[model samples]
Target: MTAGEDISVRRKKLRYRAWHRGTKEMDLILGPYADAHTEALDEAGLDRLEALVNEEDPPLLKWVMGQEEPPENIDRGFLAEVIADHSARLAR
Candidate 1:
């Protein structure tokens, strides 16, 4: 490829890498913010958190957990709710 083409390809690769790193699947599955903030996590932690998230609206659950966003996703109310609920539950 020509020099310009090479640069474009590298830029595309870098963008993809950054996006993937920010939204890695494990971050979603493991509950990134919740995991970091929560304490005393044990065998029940994952199950409990997953259950709470499922109780939330599914699309909100996806967005908060980085799974998927709704077609017109924008507001962050769901994320805020998740963080608040998780923090409160894990505090005890």
Candidate 2:
């Protein structure tokens, strides 16, 4: 596949995984966020998102919901953007 096609395929796979996370709560959170933003993400953004999604749901959900902070090693700025975006969507 061409490089563009490969990236498109990877984005689609990520979106699918986001929408199908085992828990309904995670599915709702990540699914819409992925649908709205994954296409615009650069490689580094995608890598961060992939790492976020790979994390266990309990801690991930806690972090996203603002109930707890993510580890310092995580890309907190990007995750903050995600949370802000999600919050904005909810406000509309």
Candidate 3:
């Protein structure tokens, strides 16, 4: 497959993993966001998202939910976009 096709496959896999997280809350939080945005993410953004998904749900949720601030390493510009997008989705 071409590079674009590989990325498409990777995005599909990530979307599936995001939706199938063990916890219902995590599923709700990450599933829709993944469905909407995972295809647009570049390789580095996909890496960051995978890392976040691998983390324990509570801490990840805390950061995303604004109950706790995300650390500097995770508080990148892409992450800001993710947070904004998630917030906007919640607002709608």
Candidate 4:
């Protein structure tokens, strides 16, 4: 595949993983967000997002739900925007 095709495939894989994460709540939160943002992510951002989604659901859920802040290790700049988006959505 061409580089553009590769990125598209990667984004598709990420979207599938985001939506099939074994929990309805997480699927709902991440699926839409991934669909919205994955196309805009650069390689570095995609890597971070992939790593974030691979994390166990409990901690991931905590971060999105505002139950606990994401630890420094997992707190990438891209995630801050996603978290803020999630928070705003929740507030509405």
Q: Model 2 lDDT vs. the true structure?
A: 0.88
RMSD list, candidates in order: 14.6, 1.0, 2.0, 1.7
The lDDT ranking, best first, is: 2, 4, 3, 1
User: TM-score for model 4?
Assistant: 0.85
Give me the candidate number with maximum TM-score.
2
Computed on alpha carbons, the lDDT of every model, listed in order, comes to 0.45, 0.88, 0.80, 0.85
* Clash totals in order: 0, 0, 0, 0
Better candidate number, 3 or 4, judged by lDDT:
4
Per-residue CA lDDT of candidate 4, range 2-31, in tens? Answer: 999999999999999999999888887888
Model 3 CA lDDT for position 68: 89
Clashing pairs in 1: none
Candidate 4: C-alpha RMSD after superposition: 1.7
Q: What is the lDDT of residue 35 in candidate 3?
A: 91
Candidate 3 runs further than 4 Å off: none
Residues 1-92 of candidate 2 have per-residue lDDT tens digits of 99889889989999999998899988888889999999998888889889888888889889998899899988898788878878888899
Candidate 4 local accuracy as lDDT? 0.85
Compared with the true structure, the alpha-carbon lDDT of candidate 3 equals 0.80
Tens digits of per-residue lDDT for model 3 on 1-92?
99999898989998998889888888887788789988779998788778777778877778777798877766456556667777788899
Worst 10 residues of 4 by lDDT: 75-84
Q: In model 3, what lDDT does residue 6 have?
A: 89
Alpha-carbon deviation at 9 in model 3, angstroms: 1.3
